[model samples]
Target: MSINVFAGSRKALVASIALAAVLGSVTASSAVLAADALSTASTTVTLSAKINGFTNTDWLNGVWRAAPALSIPASTANNAAFKVGASVRLADGQVRKVTKVYVVGSNLSVFLDGAVVDGNKVGAPNVLSAVTIATATTSPTTSSPTTSSGSTTTVSSGIAYASGINNFTNTDWLNGVWRKSAGFSIPATSASKSAFIVGATVKLADGQLRKVKTVQVVGSNMSVFLDGAAVNGSVVGYPNKLTAVSGSTTETAITAPTQTTLATSGLNNFTNTDWLNGVWRKSAGFSIAATGANQAAFKLGNSVKLADGQVRKITAAYVSGSNMSVYLDGAVLDGNAVGYPKTITAISGTSTSTGTVTSPAPSAPVVSAPAESTAPADTTNGQPRLVGVNLSGAGFGPSVVPGVHGTNYTYPAESYYKKYADLGMKLVRLPFLWERIQPKLNTPLNATELARLKQSLDFAHKHGVKVILDLHNYYRYFGKLIGSSEVPISSFAGVWKQIVQEVVSHPAVEGYGLMNEPYSTNGLWPQAALAAAKAIRTLDSQRWIYVAGDRWSSAYHWPHYNTQLINDPWMRDRKNNLVFEAHMYVDKDFSGNYFDKAEVFDPMIGVNRVKPFVEWLKSNNLRGYIGEHGVPDFSPSAIVATDNLLAYLRQNCIPSTYWAAGPWWGEYALSLDVTSGKARPQLPVLQKHAKTANSCSSIGPL
Candidate 1:
């Protein structure tokens, strides 16, 4: 089974691939344009222009536009000469692709893709030229070649055959052939047999056009010979071509939807209202309503036009008992408050389609997340302020389960406990592999691994830091899920029972994290968690138990998938000492990898993602803990977001640990570990939020 491990090795590989893909797609097209080299096509326009200024109304949505309107020729203005996908070359030698273009009167506004890196100097004092490519007049013909008994047939003058083909090797194209490489394989499916037939004009990554000369296929392997070797430019492989701009004879004015107050009571009392098609459309105005019946409309794949005028797709949504909370493409809408009715003047009809495309609309005003809630009003007196970092290294080399301790995976250094404790962090989340501790199912803990864990705990106690025993297994044992017949619930519970018996009396031990980011494919995590908690209580009744919900224990998804933990009687902890744990990341995909620079950072993203989980805890009267949360140090906005998130957690009287700190995490973006005798950039942010209190009196109940 391919489990999503929390180690940096896998994340680094993913980041590398993502970075390469981005570079391969955009590097070739983003070259500096040569003067007087514009395409001769009638649709392409080269104009001398000056950049007046810049505007960043909706930069997150790629709405950063050049300010002060530029004069547009009357003849070209009506032809949609500055439409999206047009190439723009500024006088300062910077080239950008047009994302949006607006025309009013004789003035033109051009929105460009990318962030405002150089301030006012970006496109200043220079003539701007735009090339609007027209759509193809004719489609590529599809003609299959006739095959003779033992001879291969060549196809000429037809569309490039790309059916059933996922991707191609970058180096193969340079060799005038498309052959299977070590990094890639040609599909063996019948549909792929016709792909890349000879004579098909295939466009290379650098926009160069070429034709196939010959083709061969043998089972799962295939090779296509091109007429000539393709040049491997800055863009290494196939390019994702830009959309063509179509001309419009008539000019259309884009206007913002007028706001009108609805007659209904809004979200104040959602249960008393009726929901239709996922929205409550009154005669006066429109309001999005959340209920069980129309819950599908507010789901992840759905889109919504918020009051701010931005059309955003829902990344996540949870509706329960007339209450609804949703994330607008990872940004929390209305602090993710349940039943916090989003009263808007207008709303698009509930769309089942996942695409976020919409007709051109006026730029939406920028809006930040709701102001951080004050802590004094909500936080109970004497609540524990547990702040710390996740001490890693012990859970490494998961692929080599039960591998040699020092050679494959080693425990974190005992000195890290004092280093973090001196930094005012008193709680340490120690992650170790379950397979290493208990090599066999339902067996006693491994003596060597158990001793190593005890030594780490002893060091933590010496530094007066509490430890949360984090079982860094994704609710799996040897690639099998907890509830699977291969790894039964009894075996999982038995392992926990043995672990508690060994460390229940340790002074440094704070709680038993039942499992790290449990992902139960068969919906068996809740049952498995309850069973483990019961077994732990039979031995140690006082130590708190941390139970993570399903789906990688994502904070934004808690209400959607973990409500059963509160509603189902069987899933409840018998001792009422369970503290629900969730993890949140501020990246676009919530994967903690910050490889894409185009994904604009929003400071409220951290608050937005964790609000649903915090609200869920408050509504259910349960204690909560953030087991994992961190941001890359390179992003200033991400650092600010982390500070805001930590403040929000402090205000709510909830404790959290930054992920993570260890000797082995060299140059890790989110690592708080000291490097070259200097603290990492993210360490000071953790220090600012770290608290000395170690008591859990403030947090209670499962």
Candidate 2:
């Protein structure tokens, strides 16, 4: 699996937490001060200038640059008259609290809370009105305290105060309540030192009130619980202020929004629309009538105008309840969820006359093989002649490089080779980390790792399975990407040269996959792949060389990123033994994780995604292969999609390998491993399409 795919869900969750902290703050209090009462000094300023630009500083904050640079008081730390935690009103009449105050080369830049709009966290340029700053006053007021009989008197105030409020960093939205993580300090100087009891109410910096639920003080730091999540547009962190409100702690009842089923008919006659909350709905208008079986009007490939007024064809459509959602050309318009149809200006190719249209049945398309003139004379009607599964265990545990052989990561057992070969699978794509094979860049291959790799090749040779040596590194070695000063292209080429020198004569070695999925921001993968291929050619010119494209080698994006490989003269192989490799997945994120059944909403998803790559190969007369593709065994729709995808590949004479079969993938949804002598659900599908022809000789002229 792609590392990016594995970490996609985690990255999203972290972003949600950061967003909540910026939009609102949780209030809880503990301890009280007995010393003289402290009063805070504050100042307010109004500016009539409009915001000319906005820039995002980070996930939780952004800077609003005033037009023509507004002159304001110095915002340095010593000048507490104007600093962070200041509240400001925008020209649009919206109030926001400042998180940072700085000058960008004489232009005042006020950093404030940020919100996500159109799938990105960005600041909107608005007019500036006023900014208010507050500072603790130096002067103090004395207050007398009551004393017990015959005991020394101690000064105390009945009000509670929480100090070190600025140190609270993390926030979470739990049970509809936004809460600050524990470990914040409460100074023991206030009069009512323990007034932060349960059921107490405290007011946050933004003036929003919250009720206390639990209070636990561990030494100086206290963990106090608050009621209710952060309100939208509320600021989280305040520099030096947290005031306890004196009142009864009565909880407010929150009402849930009512769920209503809207109409889905007359969607083809939309006037205006917008994509919001991962669905396309009417921006402003009344709901249309509900769509029944007799009134269905939209099909899979009808062209319609979106909110932006651009016409796009619908690739998939389905109705859930009374709302209908459509996907345009397989594009994930907003996350994985499809768009709910709303009012639009026009929709073409569907008859609205009689209010009756045919809705496409959720079934796989019948794809026929096209005649291939470029195929060799012996090619069997352009059918895919090689099918197999990836033997994936040596690539696990990437964090522990050069780890223990079996405990951290292991190689596929010899029995796997015999078992798969007996099932008519003659190809095996073996994934191994480059760092494990060559521990140090531009250095000799590790003896133990090299020996272990050779043993797998020997097993392949014994079982008559052709092996593709796949370097399962994502264009990096030890966290450093290729083409960087630390890891140059020469180092990448050097490793391939050494690998080829060791395994060139092995009969099972069908090809050398330079890299598994080269995703780099420096745009140097094409050059690095060309250099690696040249290095391997110098050692052995007959073996095929497979070059994977950037962006995880996604088949859907092959034409956009890999067309340069076909046009560049330096990338040409003298022996014509080069093959392009790409990967495809039916899931919405293309991660191949398939955590949800809705990911495979359309049965023809696989065929639609791989069409571009297949067309690119046929049009350019180039040899192409699918290096990785799989579907979860639990989803029947996903299985049908996989079958359709394999059938399309066979028609186009392109081979593919299932994502995996390894001893370590226990309970993995895509694994082909047998459990308790019962075959996995996806195993029969692979067995039905298994082919053993010499793919290299059969696809193109040799």
Candidate 3:
């Protein structure tokens, strides 16, 4: 995948190929490309500033897109990367223009002006995506991350499975059924199960192994489930007309997977700086450090394999002049610390089912709620439903507050829910950390927390609002959930047990979020997490559970995990329960529209921003919501970002809540009127414009 890394004012649009060159043997830089066609012209812009982490390819990608505006419509040669003799020219010339950023077949070479530079590129093979410059040597830039609506995806899971399917069956019937059934009341029609003939896109829920696919029967009536728990029979966007049909399986092309070479960055430790970098090194621990011109490997873990039987554990490591001191778990591996790769030795891990990793697709991707587009049109629709927010009570703030402070805050817990309930709010999001409820492994929530939780549930019940208690944090880095007391990763099951035992009886607690942003660094989530979810099913059969996307909930990352739902994936209380959730926050390119300085006054550019994500949800047959979104109100720069955001919601018809409410976020508050002191100028915007959710009237497309 091509990444756009920006370096200062200049943005670099590099692919995962072209970044193997050295610039002054200095710190790695993020650079953007300037367009200069090889057709026979030259327009150059001098490198102004530089920043680390950008590849030359990043600049190439940016310049290509921004070309129309630069008024320099340079043509591209074959989709080649730094394949010698490529150049570009601007209206005025001074800088060299590079095109086609592709890494040179892993040898890691760069064409600077014209010469090959080596011993410069470093880092893990995939961790640092490279760039390809038209020529060997090109300056670099970076892709600034802006976090937009469509790109950043949050995949949420549900608990539902059909019965009696063989090992690894695509489960086509179920796939079509789920999509057709998504966002609607079920049993509305008597069409044969064959009606759900169309196949679906497989999507992975954050941290789960069993991939699930949702598809729809054109013109069939169904039930709607928001975040896994049924919301209402009348779905806002569900279509009500079924098209008469023949059923057939749709097939797609799958390209043969190709093997790629790995990078060997900092390798002074061993003459062969090959198979022992990053975690691959059996050392005590490791951390990424930047050096003046380069970086190298350091140790933090214990008993590592180094050159010549070097055995030791790391005690400490810090910069000493130009090089890094090594510390093994007991000793350190002395070598270049900058530009280090994990390990050159080919190490492998088993691919086990964590839940659903890849969703099976029998048909092409569909991003709209199912309808017989070929059948009829129903312009007449229904009213939208009332909306609410998930402040994720009993949750956390790794960004600012970390561990236990959420409980310490009284403003939102005691005050905000009451206000939202009184404000005619329809929902409130409450995310729970499994580790918090059951501090001890295999145990349940301690008495104090249980009692407090029950009281809050009772309070919400008293007010006219529904509660969505989601398990926000899961077993992760360092074993415990982020921002919570440290606990063993295995403690997840214990926490689940505690939750079902304590809250299963309460009617006020409407739904549950399985885990918050379960990011599978690459794609799939950890397996243990899915098993914990299954256990939760045995406890509360009727509860609506939410599964999310991995990689911090980026939707782009979800497609790889999408799969067809198998029969009886999980049967809780005999109810076909749950909904899928996806979060949004696209990469910088999609969100960069925020910088359109053209608007002296706040001008909206994201009118089309929500299109991509909303379309994705509709096509997947998953009932979804924008769980979290917000900006520091003080950043007037976001004035346009904010305006574009609201417009995005209106255009896509997706519901969302600001990142927080009440006073807990003293610095990042959208508004403090509810209490907790996080009040900002954007309070009313959330109240009136947050998540435009509603019950479906006649059915089809909200």
Candidate 4:
């Protein structure tokens, strides 16, 4: 018998063979040669300005598809900690053994037993995954069993047994013929004189097992009840090669098996500082401050300590077909992997034919309905809530675009919208660059540009996703600020004038984000925001207009009394239709530049950080939206922070959208792409929030 295994490199594979010899070799040599190569190890871990958690299912799901390589950054000092044969866990909960370790330039790469991570060099976070150092590495010793069966071998009770051929004097099957049977009924006795009881296990000639639901014997006519119908056949006088098992078997009512699944959120807690300096210890508790990485583990319906050392129980966990849910105090916590792996492996035991029979084939309906929605139900009213991710490809090109930037952007297919729709997403923040809308100043919208944008909007609308056309230029145009004399505010407004006319009344076009992350230091951003808002208002008065702040539209900077753009008088008009927008990122410095924390549990950083901005909107009776916020792909703290942020948003009836979910963010430090097509450690968080906030009260009429 042969089993397949994955390793990081040839050398690692050799080490794996040695490790397997100790672990009692589960895989063959052919499988050992299938090790995938990873990038050679380098000196440091790569650092980038990447956020986490928020993933878009449209462009790419979170599943990791390619071979994985370690992209160790030049700054990482604990290179010795990671070695061939070390145990590591991927973001999707799969544990793998390291095969080979490579050092190329300043980066470190390796091969894993299974390649669950992406193998990219550019822009990817080059950090080793969570590692489990064995206390004392030792090899396995193989052993074999020797036993013999006696005349009367004990049939151990509670032990599962197969029902092919078994010797039992009490339980014996005699040949029987088909007869015209009616209602299900138990026979008084067997034709061979053995008791034909209801609980007796009987196997037909084809090896299918069925209990006597209601066996009937009418003058040598016999009927076996199964599948809610009775089988009619004539009873045979003798057991002619016909078999039957004595003991009953019960496989249903089994809970899913316990498996150690890891979430790719937080990096290794025991890093160089902790390992070399011997300062890894922290106050043991549930809070992020108290607990270090790998200190705890959980699954659906499990319990764990909170940041404050408070033991909290998982309120609910249930799997229905493909949909699985996990609740904390009745509120949904995102990232519950339901139906991915069958929780309960069917166990064979004694059968109990207590009236109702288990499905004869032992297979329940895997899918409740074809194309049934896994998304949450629609809101009470007709208007649906706008809970979704952003699609970010059209805005990828040159920020200062007089010089051409790369044009490798591709429009998403209709399948993308359908994918999100299936996940209960009703809103999409579609970001396209101003350069694409107008290649040169005062030029007509390009034919390809219009068609592509229109195609995206049409497809999204057709699939029930509302579109939010976002001009993601950061308030700059070809190296010129919007309000600067070089590119007057009118030029920016003119672009909207063309765009607004084209999509003003489209049913799917819910609103227009004037600009993404405007960072104008001067007071030019307020003027730019108003210019675009008024331009759109002229074309359509009722549609919502989103206006961002000056300093990157940051939530931390939104309420700065002196520089805040939301306080501008021009933004107060059409109050109900105008939504102030701001973005938030949580780290030690309130920037999404690093992913060092194992988890984030502080209300100060998670909820308190955004409280001021949300409160400002409430005090002014203004509605607002979180235009962008996301956590890292491999941090538990990121997940906690994102959940806290979203919970706060929903509690205050504020609507928000997650940042940069498109497939273009390959290996970006904050990408949620667990795979090329599926998301992990992030999608569950999004789904949990979407399903919990079932009310569309936050979203007004279109």
Candidate 5:
């Protein structure tokens, strides 16, 4: 039988071969007859179970068996086919063609036609194509074969679909953005299947164009994956959704650029303990003071390699009393041992002060300006002194407190408020936990917790003392850090809203303190406090809101918070309705641990260092609160410093609250607990400034 042959493109070759089979007498086309010797040709065959042999002359019985190297089990469970006379493609773009085939264990192995190796083995499964038995004579004619332009896929035993395709290797796919319309259809036909191969890009119904990573075929059905996930549809009936993006379009992962100006002023106002201790990369305008400086260094931007393996941005130079501070990234790094990383080998500029002047010795504090302000009044009878003490132990954690969580609460005796009232105190700062208020995000306050808190408020009211509800969690909820990805600024704001809504109606509640000593990292405190302030104003619009600054709300860090405060929406929306809070402890380390001789005499460690902070507040026409201040009565220095600090607050008309008075303080140094109807040693100093005894009798609740 003469078989008609035609040589041309793949589509033409397939059609001519099929048509010629029906017209058996047709002659070979001139193109086919004059074609070069058959160097390469391939076809497809279904994979089947391996048999022992050629099946005892199965060709006569019309039972076709797999050729050698075709009996191996495939990598996947899906049906597969073989393409004969085609070269197997490897992942590295190398190809090896099979010349001879044989069965190896239920699998078949191919030999290189005649080449002999000890095992006659190349490998299993990496082979590209296979061939099927045909009736035509297996002979080659001489002619130059045509080379195909696009890739040719071969169905061979153990050959997985699109196994070596890499989208990243082709700049055409990776560099250009791709798209597809809604409801695009994917083709399931074999030829179309080859076009929508793995590593191709496809658009989803949501308009997101993602790379196709997974493809599966079972019988006639096909599934294509996008964004590492599969789309829902039958392969053939879906719309043709994918198209190469030609116009300007956005990449899914790339966002529009945003500019971040380096924090210049906030850095100078805040101290970074890390940057201060690190090796100073000093330059012409910046200098690190080994001893005290007569003149302040000129503020200049620089970088510091921290011990924690982070590079920090530093700016600003501050001379606070005897201690000098270098501000970095919105806070001062406090330490003596901080140094530069060894990797930083060079300094870019000289270290010098812009205006050097002779300075006093370390014993004398640098005085700035006197604190002056029209202090807001409190709910007192004919007087406006803020002489109340803090309730220390009730805010302890692990027990549920209304509007808070993670607190093990303690309730002071109802008589303590009366006791403080009897001492002529006019206000109380009631510290509380955040976890017990709203244990879960977006959840309401616990009813029982609210009742307990109301009881405390009633006690304060019964004693004629106004209450300042304090969030004592230090700007955190359990393990969740505010201003972070886990607990965003809105979470803090939302919780405050719940707290304010529940207690805004209470007459004894004078104000809300956002957070106590919010010493947070990442410059998050200002934003977090502002969010909470905004939330509170949404419901209780007219109430006074107190916001604490970063670095434990240190009086030293007041300048930074002042800058943030002026720019805060809360400040802009409600002018003269906000109060800045700061904490002070007169100790050697400023942590209220141990007192030095200068704790009393040296203004830097006591009353003098706060002059700049007070001046800043007064200059901005902003009122503030000494949220927490305490000095131990162990020595005369502590007593003297305590007296001086209170005098400073009273003289400036700044509302102030003593650190704490609780039943559990016992002998704790800073405790001002009243026991046996007698106050702690610090009580006399507190009473000396009471409304009736001082000039603050005219001030009232804010």
Candidate 6:
């Protein structure tokens, strides 16, 4: 924008005449040939307009610098001449002022500020010629701002508590520039928490724009995870304008949907103490923060696994104030450093993928359990079917009962062993100690103890009943009490191998019960137990091995096969030599009993009054056996199904060792007087059941 200033020169006169000739058929460049070219030019000619060889040119790239006529002052005309402020516009898109006025001859040359050609005219090639300035006014200079560098994302806080700000402004207001479609879909299979990316926009419940989240699906869920760093960000009213030419204008914007991010680890966030502590894993699909009404750890609408990866691959997540977060694909190794608001990063392990994720349709609900086989082997007549009992082994006892078992310190007497066979006991249970045999590392079994153990085994052989040797106490325990299954595997396995070697030759010992209730969790217990199984198999192939589950004696399914804990020949069990064990206490550490005293609480049915744990045991390869279960005398319905419980035992055609033979042993330990010779009412039930159990031998299901 500029004001025109010129001197007395022929340039101004020729410019006016050429402006007039562009509207006519006459050539405006005739003045250069016969001093007559002053017409046939565009009405808005630039002050430095170049008349290249003079034909009407296509170089119209300048702005007009004159004010509207409404702002003009009335001035007297002298000999058809008018005086007005001069505002010059050049072909380069720059508009300024021109002061000098000039009139040379019939072929006039234009000048500004009493000077000749202060700026250049750009028309056609070598055709820069102006006639005169007719109506002129003052032009002003104006400008606006625009982005020189591209937009970027920034986190105001640390990664642990990340926030997002896209299309964000400092002022508090709802901006529509950033919003996600109500039913937008992202890549994830299971419920998940997604990481937000920069430069993208998402819509909030308040209709404001936020950071957009791009996610990946991993292991039955989305790989997208949050980087905890969100501090402050929001929707701004407007964007800074552009400078230079005012031709095109655009505003920066970002709109996104409300997504959930989660930190799927650490026990502090949950109040339930019994809940297992571990990474719940971020699966494929969409994940919402704990902010919205439907915020959850998982969010799978239509998730599928990608071609290169396995099923939905989930990862770990961290916390960021209120938002939950998970990082996948592009995540860092330490898992702590992800660029803020960025969705999934690097990834390891397998991935899960599927369709879109949204709030409209919910994902399928999943229950934590191990996969099971479709069918189990049939039990036939006298085929040594799977059967056992939970001894509820006592932690305290006087001298062990003699002659029924091997070196186990706690035992039922030799006479009791005979009684067991008399009443048809097939498997005698004995839960022993972690503090005894290998008390501090390489300790060997004592001679006196070994002698006692042989005496007991001889007695069992004299009668007829298989003796099960259980490594009841893991070496990690300091005393008779149980320690965590988290002890180092090397020490535990070393001791386990020694114990296995000791019992391999014992004819009375039918099997070696591996770690009692080893957790199937992602830990060393299972791995170490499997190692012990390998050692046992290597030492004595004929004997069977028992392995218990993880928490709560979970026997359904064990850990993943990839754990490689089970040594070689894992699938090579032609002997059907493996038995998985479970211990069922009443719900809540002893809740109401499903059946009264005599009735059986078969977990085969659903989980109700009875524990459904036994069915879970069969789900994984291997037979199910109750290592521990009992009824309290306090239970009012003691003898209700004493008949059915006994009948069912017989119908299954499986052997069960009664929990007690000694008058005051085991459950009686806490109640009955040790010196009391009285019998528990359940003894009669066991005797009756044992008598009837043989009936199923001929009428077997198989």
Q: Which one wins on lDDT?
A: 1
**Per-prediction TM-score to the true structure, in the order listed:** 0.46, 0.46, 0.40, 0.45, 0.44, 0.37
> Of the candidates numbered 2 and 3, which has the greater TM-score value?
2
True-vs-predicted CA distance for residue 667, candidate 1, Å:
0.9
lDDT of 5 by residue, 50-95 (tens): 3212222111111121111222332232112322222332222223
CA lDDT scores, all candidates in order: 0.53, 0.53, 0.34, 0.45, 0.44, 0.32
Error of 4 at 151 (Å): 92
lDDT of 6 by residue, 641-681 (tens): 33343344344333344333332232332122123454555
Give the TM-score (vs. native) of candidate 3.
0.40
* Superior by TM-score: candidate 3 or candidate 6: 3
Q: 35-149, model 4: which lDDT tens digit per residue? A: 1211212112222212111123311122212223333432344345445444444433334444434343454444444323432321133234545422221323112111010
Report the CA-based lDDT of candidate 4 relative to the real structure. 0.45
Give me the overall lDDT of model 6. 0.32
Candidate 1's C-alpha runs over 4 A off are 1-383, 570-575, 674-678, 692-697, 700-702
Report the Cα lDDT for candidate 5: 0.44
Clashes of each: 0, 14, 164, 77, 61, 155
Residue 309 lDDT, candidate 6, scale 0-100: 28
Candidate 2 scores a C-alpha RMSD against the true structure in Å of 29.5
lDDT of 6 at 612: 42
> Model 1, 1-702: lDDT tens per residue?
133344224333433333333334400111111111223234445655544443443221222321212323323632244554455655445455444444434445564543232334443444466655353435443233211111122323233344323254442232222331101123434544434433234533333333333333323444433322123322423333211111111111101122222222244333322223233211111224454433545443334544444444343333322444443421223312323344432232222222122222223211111111101101111234357888877876677789877655667776787788667776888889889999998778998899999899877755556788999888888988888889999998999889887765444577899988877557788778888988887765456788988888889988998876665663443335678999988877666766575566788889999999999987776778999998876778888888888877866657888887775564567777634446467777777777322222245321
